[model samples]
Target chain A: MKTRYHIRPRHNIRPQSCIYALLASISVAVFSLPNAAHAAGTLAGTDIQNVASATFDTAAGPVTIQSNTVTIKVDELLDVTVSSTDPGDVITSPGQTSNVQRFRVSNTGNGDEAFALTATVANGGDDFDPSLQQIVIDANGNGVFDAGVDVVYTAGVNEPVIAPDQNITVFVITSTPAGVVDTNRANVSIVAAAVTGTGAPGTSFANAGQGGGNAVVGPTGAQSSASGFLAVQATSVTLNKTATILDPFGGNRPVPGAIVTYSLVATVAGTGLLNNLVITDPIPVGSQYQPASLTLEATALTDAADADAGNFNGTRISVAAGNVPAGQTRTVTFKVLIP
Target chain B: MKLIIRIMMAFATLTGASLAVAATPLQLSSDVFVERTIEGVDGTKTVVLEKPKMVTPGDSLVFVVKYKNVSATTATNFVVTNPLPPAVAFNGTSDGQEIVSIDGGKNWGFLGDLRVAKEDGATRAAQRSDVTHIKWNLNQPLTAGAEGKLIFRGVVK
Candidate 1:
């Protein structure tokens, strides 16, 4: 900041210097009314403006003594904002490394700031954990991060510094660990704190050099943080079918006029979901589907073509299975008679 | 440093016993997830199993607190308080009867019952955004060897 101002008379006076000191002291009392408790030597936000007027009796009857008003403003102001635009980008397949999300960091405050960066998996509330999470910046200027095309982000001196209003887009790369099941989620958080002050190169949050004229989080204008997560999705399903036949002689045989019972079970092996399921099985050769013999587990349906009962389109049999959830299976059974 | 708290849940069948907090042993853990809808193989609407992952703005997060009675006795009068993260906005709680504190745990009540002082110095009905913390007081004693869960939700700011 333009060196803190102090009252000074042009001439050298013994008792007058003491009075000038009093004036400076009075000015300090005015602005410090509401202490702007900045975090450290990082100054941003509101400026202090004031003027002083003192009236007194002079050589004449009554004269007014008014001193010029001095204003103090922050030059190297500090302000910044960081956010992930994509928010909840997802990646679940294990061993897959990709740029699934993007973040933007901008210097919204006056002057410049070198933002220190960091990333975390989660603060809890996740179904699964992040396998290998990393942060990257678009090194080639292409919105997309091509393999071996982007650069990894590391904190310290020489970090990317942005001027006021200017912003950069960075990517959050993640890989799901092996064996992560469906519904497992990993939350990732990224932080960008402004790095200011002199002795710049090596200075960090600890022993950090003075930044913006004030401290970090010091009664200030802005601080930026970005966070989000990746959730895993892997669905697996299986179907089981069986058949049993009975002959007219009460013996098991595939003979004409014999009734055959068929069962089909649809089950999901792992955490996953299958919707709008329509099961179709062509009618067996030389066999006739008993229209009224269709049963979904226990309930019997009409033999008609429009009801919940199994439908036979002259050659194919179809059944509607709305949705199949993980570990949830539905079975459809019907009887058919040989021609 | 951000802490990833893991809440484990246990289901105990013991019932009919009333115990005090001092007499029962309790365990708690927490996890988060985002809900998403996707297509199903049955030609109907299905869930994508989005799970918890990289979130974007406007995503709703389900915060689940799994609790179990690890001790040999049942417990009651249990209370749990969870503070909202700075980057999150409390849209609502899965426990509708649960009271919420918006003034940093200073005072709490239902959304419709609470009020906030505005910049103009007028106190008006509080909104969901004013929520800061959630409190859960189990209505029933958690029996020994019994496990269950409590859940609330918020959005990533």
Candidate 2:
């Protein structure tokens, strides 16, 4: 009975029909199975790597750069990473005689970022003369680089690309002008730029392979600043006086008179050049103003004509022009007569 | 088919709820304070140093005042006035604050309306009042927990 039934069931089902049924079943199974894994893979293409923030030390203090990273998808085509390194704190004393002061510039980022380091000094509003205080660019940040060893670059071209965890040194030098004064403070700014690349080794996978490839990384820039104070001091000023009496009382009673000599000295205790400075010591009430016989001497005076008329004859003696450089002492001598 | 539809609807609802939770606004709070005091040559002198510190004759003295709005509602059209001290000399100023001293702080006018005499006996339009105090005319309402500072400078005698 089973054999008879088996032959009777398939009257006219074509082989082509069977083939079509099999194809339909396969199509249905393929469509029904989850395609989430493929969708996720496509999404990985869109993920981008970026720098969240950057920080560095500067002479002005701790300088920090924030959220300069931009995301880019394959379709978008453009991506940017911004970062900066600051020069740590800087220190300079008043009247630092050293030709150069050194500063260190370092990067403190985990990612291997590249940056251009450039320094700009706003000499405290032209407080420093460029000719007087030479600004020699020492490619190496070390302060001790000799002139022969240092290389100076042109603007924009001068900056060097620094790698992460790397640093350079710069030096500030003072020229040896005879009466150069450093009274104003100077501000120096150091800026850094970040080099663009794929995310640091581990983060690249989060966005799927889509993010890792086809992203253009650009440099992120940052700046650090510092200030220095320069002060010129005047140490001292001295005045000497000589006095002579002419033939008083006309007698041998010890010539009835005596020759008198005195010295007046003034010292500047503070920094800065004193302009239009005048010094006067009036004759005491008991003494008469002597004229036509007083002599004066001064270090800052270029010529005898530079001395004021009152310095010789009047009650007050004045030095027309006086300049006291830092750490220098000046002296003046004068003669007076008692009649 | 019905069971599958129900599961799909439930998943959609959960996703919607999660998205809604992520869109909430963040609330923040802040505070500020301001204080002003006057000290004269003696303890009771009428002169109010723009700032509460001693200044040299030629030095620049800057006076700053700060205030904060702590109330939930913004404070609108607020006004503050500072009288100039007699010993101080007024210089040029920037920003919104005005300088006006008439009859010794008895009346206030815009600095452009005042007349000043120069050392060479020439007269010029006074742009700033010899600053004894500073006043702020706030046009915008200060939001809750919002703080601001006003600054002015003068030469100390």
Candidate 3:
């Protein structure tokens, strides 16, 4: 929002009279005050005026006196705050690439300011150090990482300019090594500082703030940093199979014209997610595969590769058990007839 | 009978007589300052007032109003009224005789005796931000060439 000032013409009129006229005109000007809910408090360059008057009774009559108007301009404050938004240690498998750690940087000052952002994975408090890639901003602000959609950060080029009490979401992308151990953690941190300058609290930069006013460092010192963690987890999926048979007019034995039912169970173990896991079972050499007898956890599956999870390709039965997390299990069953 | 013949709020002009010698008997001036606490080497702190060249929100300010009687006669029933700026909030004053108005000079009383209406149609105690104007009634008469000051405090919003 633009701030408008109504300055009265100052010519032959005295300074007091000019101020009075300016104050009167100011009430009519469309002045858009900064949002009151903003943590930055108030906008810079706001003019505050005060005037007083006295009335007295004299022997001749009653007289009223008007005081000179006093005005003061509000200066700009420089402050920034950064924090990690990750719910917990981001779980990733070994040799995983494109791992991301989310963070948010906020401009907590009373003026518009630019910030220079930097990310590093050289922090030594973790088990393994993940190779740091480039930092990217959530351009759409959806909090999810999208390659080719998010903008990459470059120092001195396209630094984020944030308004007072506004924030931007940033992602620190990294790649874990292939030989890393399970349950290991790596730390990556990002630091954001005001592009104008940074120093001890109360430090002032002349005419470097919005509206050409002096900028003062606030309690934050105009810089802030936050760290996010990435953890490595190992995972594997195992499948077990069992078969049952029944004859036409006798006990359960592998006889001619006997119907055989096969069951396969796939169980995932470890603290990581097993991606694109699939289970397959082949029919016996002397038996004919039954049609429409394939079932996944008691759910029927068609022979064609349709939208369902299980499908048959004339040679074997395949079930796509996509992304199985740790401590989870999946079951698939099919049937065949003895020739 | 003691009758107030005329009351003028403008530049105090007189007509139909010796207009050349027409000047108000009282002079009023206003000034604002920012206060800073300076710590000495002996662990002592002193508050110093300085002209505000650079002020920001949440900063404390002091306003001073000076009035003097410049005529040979005396000024009686003197009352000083100050309208608080929109960008500032009234902090308490050291003077105990000040009266405040919450509703645009419609009602006046001590802060403790004032009540403001809330949006829920209920009345609640008035706070400092509710103050719109401050007034001080000087019952004592000002003799010739006598000057005094009224000081109050405020914080930039």
Candidate 4:
């Protein structure tokens, strides 16, 4: 948008002067609000000075007198904010180890201060308690976690000291034990507090601020906590076998040279994915092997150990169902003759 | 007794002002204090002013300007002006006759009658944060040895 300024011609002011006035006013309006609304309020140790003046008429002449200046130094505010970095409940399998729930701690105060960190996994409202491992900080300041790079947090040791408006990422490591039912959730929480002190708002710690000024707790009470949970999804597989007999005498009796058909159905359960699932069945003692009779999900397989998932040795049949999703079933059928 | 002593002092000052021919006779002084609410043992709360030792953001402060006329004659056309500190935002004053400046003392008027220029070449109703200075006029003449104080409130930005 273009702005047009109409200057009265009778004022005898030059056009260039008008342009300068316009620019000066525009700059002042744009820069004034941001300087007043700084998020981290005024910096500590800032001296604010004020003076008052008065002018009055005297019998001899007009006179003006100014007052002495009074100065006040700003004190520091101690506040902290903690929030969960994870989008939602983290998905994990039973017996999973070293699963991490992330949280970010920020220093929302106007001073340089150290924060003490604490984590708890044995929360009462959780379905199953996850064993507490250790709390670690993002040592390199990177969002991604590195096993050996990140620093493990210990009480009164290696605490992070952040500047005003700065944040640090923290990870809570825990392990889920076996036997925990599927769809169960375990919550973990972390708390970060100013090492100086924690108390009600306006509570002041004398001479504890960055520049030796008093430190007063802000609205956050100088400490904060955030929670994240882990959801369990267990996986397993089950197989069933059935056999049918057909005799040459047109009877369903167990006779010699009777053809027998065997079917094996494998079904996977739970919400997790099962890996390296293999099914094997040995040939019966009184049965003769039928050539090219092995089929997986109604697909034929050779009697050799080839690139296909199905293979048959002299005495047994095997099918490698690499990965199987939950609620899925696979059937393998083979024919055998009773010699 | 205190009031009598104060009045006697003012008379002595007036005598001295008459002897001096060139002195302006008007004296100004400023002070800042913080207000805190204290609860009494009987469950009554009272606000008390104390020296600001730990001033933080969003804290309320009171600025007082005291003026006195020490000359033998009445002082007329007396005006007091105070420019707010950069780190403080004007909160209001108990006196309704005061005029405020929003453009660094360039213009002055009642707060409700003032307009602030915006960067978009538009004007907006002046707000508390836009106040840059405050002024009060003593409409009546200040007689010899007369004294009074003016006050306004502000908050740390």
Provide the RMSD of all predictions against the true structure, rounded to 1 decimal: 29.3, 32.1, 9.0, 10.9
After superposition, candidate 2 runs with Cα above 4 Å error: A1-99, A110-114, A123-142, A156-158, A172-183, A195-221, A234-258, A262-266, A272-339, B1-157
- Chain A vs. true chain A, TM-score per candidate? 0.50, 0.37, 0.64, 0.84
- Candidate 1 is graded, for docking, as incorrect
Q: B110-143 in candidate 1: lDDT tens per residue?
A: 7799987777889888887777667665667667
lDDT, residue A196, model 2: 36
Q: Taking the tens digit of each residue's C-alpha lDDT, what string does model 3 give over B56-85?
A: 778899999999888999988888888777
lDDT agreement of model 4 with the native: 0.79
Chain B TM-scores of the candidates: 0.75, 0.51, 0.81, 0.79
lDDT by residue (A238-299, candidate 1, tens digit) is 77899998889898888887899998888866555666677778778878888777777667
Instruction: Give stretches of model 3 more than 4 Å off.
Output: A1-38, A140-150, A237-268, A276-324, A328-339, B1-22, B40-43
Candidate 4 has which clashing residue pairs, if any?
none
| TM-score for candidate 1 | 0.38
Rank list by lDDT: 4, 3, 1, 2
* Residue A330, candidate 2: alpha-carbon lDDT: 38
Model 4 CA lDDT for position B80: 81
Q: On a 0 to 100 scale, what is the lDDT of residue A109 in model 3?
A: 86
TM-score for all models, in order of appearance: 0.38, 0.29, 0.72, 0.82
On DockQ, who's better, 3 or 4? Answer: 3
